[model samples]
Target: MVAKGKVGILTTNYYNPDGNRIIYGGAERYGLELTKLLLELEYEVAWWQVGTGWQKEMLPGVPLYSIPETGDNFQTCPRLNQSFYEQAVQVDFAIYFVTFLAYPQVLEKSISISHGIFWDYPSFDAVIPTEELRRERLRRLWLAFNGPRKIVSVDTATIQWATTTWPGLWHKFEYIPNFVDLNLFSPSEQERKDGKIRVLFPRRLTSVRGINEAARAAEILTKKYDNLEFHFVGRAHDDNLEKEMVRWSAKHPNIYYYWKAPQDMPHVYQNVDIVLIPSKSTEGTSLSCLEAMAAGCAVITSYVGGLPNLIIDDYNGLLIRPTAANLTAAIEELAFNHDLRKRLGQKAREVAANFGLEKWKRSWAKVIGEVFK
Candidate 1:
């Protein structure tokens, strides 16, 4: 067992120069929150950034280091060389935010916290859906084979997915739900002025996330409830899918599209009546759903991946199949009944409390304590 001492976090930094304080992405936000939790537990913490162009100004009071971007051959990269190993050796343990298992030297004393599996899943944006990409993906599997001393997943479904995809790795697995800052996403007492029922969809406009399905649902729902408004927030120029969404928005006035500005999320959630997550791909316990629940917004999502575990249908929130008809039905049900929305929102808040900052701190402390013991 590794001795208990200061812990180092190896993660990608998300400091943008646009003056946004809060990072919206799940993995980046998770790493930051984990660092805060470790600090609260009285464990000295340090950050090792793997990529370049990260702003240091936002990361005040935290000791930081940067790793130069390695080309295709990451083995020869200085970031993966002996110097990097020597620097990380100072810490008692290292927690990798994602799968960087190609460098086994670092994995010797490291724990892996993965958002998703590295090999089995195919990139949704890749143009070549051929055998070449499949073989390349197979080659990447070797990196994960080296793996980490300990593996942490965000939810039971994630753990199960990982184990099912790769057998004989269950013994090293542990479940630790994602933590969120409840203070930032609190319920507002101010009445929503807009007569239209506002629905927020905060996801990348891509096929994997089922954004097309969301748009289709909006098209169907608009026929019945003309006052309904659908707002999508994410990268606008990243893909052609977003361009298609923009075109759809132009045709329909009720549909709105906003480029994701990190600081504006809390305000966005505050104004919306419900949050929708209609992902068709594998999800690693969505942070967007958790944030919406914390903000006292009724969540309507598909019963896929870790979503079902986070949201209990008709209890904390509503879970529907990944279909336009079902999604439209769920939205219609929530929009007509104000009391049901209030009850679901209250239950969601209660569930989110379990994943508060303090709870995560305690969980990390216990894990570190056990590892040292």
Candidate 2:
């Protein structure tokens, strides 16, 4: 097939700019799938992201470039976007992997993505310390919103937030939830030989992801229940955080901490009996939650951001406020009730079928076709 046209994509970071290690996270996975979709649609693709001005290959032929521009107090990098816009002049279209990256100026044929609201937490107060700073940030975001032809929001909470913040811009958004590869994350047919109830926390070691709550719950529940085991299966932002988790896990019985590549996650998901997505804030319809549901694991997640979109309390999965006590109780209840576990897992898999990879591709293709044509 003849290539349609070249598309330049800009992001914050696809990988560590100084090294070859790829950042394994939900947003990175979304970017990968989006790039693959563009490739499947016969568009030549190149990527730009914040780094030490190095160049690498994202795939076989797709080039990934880096820019040295740094963000300011608002975390908006206009210089990076401007750099991308200027350097990608030969490209026919553009994609802002992050919404804020399109600020100040953007190409005519471009769109942006919103992973969800990142400013919902209390610590964001330090980022925008004054009213003037807050207003300036809003002004930049407003300009960013106007720059993109359409903003693809991964969850409804983002669209809701945008509309509430700036009421007249409802026409600028498209709702497309995150997706999962059902074939890869399917349930195990065989029963567990060890007869242990395993619970998985498949998220980064961050406070917003409720890692603290999860850790507290793990410490409490593992000590209380002999048959229960807790697994923490994701990386932290720094080596210190990783070391802390490793040391903490080492000190506790029935608690384990390890990280796995995105491709290797299917086996890990399939082996687990339960999944916890205890996000306190700043989330979308998470890939981990969807993959867990697809793997037929009974999921317990917090009612924050887009998590509620995936789970219904006592229906497909358990949705609750993210607290150490609440998580411990949920795990305890699931551990004691085998029938509830089986039912929730079965329903979760059934609900997860609606967000399959093919459907996601078709939805994205429609939007891309309309914008790029």
TM-score to native of every candidate shown: 0.77, 0.97
Candidate 2, 236: how far from true, in Å?
Answer: 0.8
After aligning candidate 2 to the native by TM-score, how far in Å is the CA of 147 from where it should be?
A: 0.9
Name the candidate that leads on TM-score.
2
* Per-residue error (Å), model 1, residue 282: 3.5
Question: Over the stretch 1-373, how does candidate 1's per-residue lDDT look in tens digits?
Answer: 3323677776544433232333456676677677766666666777765444343532456666655544423212335433455767777777766654334445355676767532323553353366876555544543543455666777777577656867777877777787767888778779787787899888767665667788888888776688889998875324476677778788887889877565678888888888888777667778888889998999998777678768999998998876777888888899889899999999999999888867776776677666633
- Candidate 2 lDDT: 0.91
Which stretches in model 2 have alpha-carbon errors above 4 Å?
A: none
Model 1's C-alpha root-mean-square deviation from the true structure amounts to 5.0
Clashing residue pairs in candidate 1, if any? none
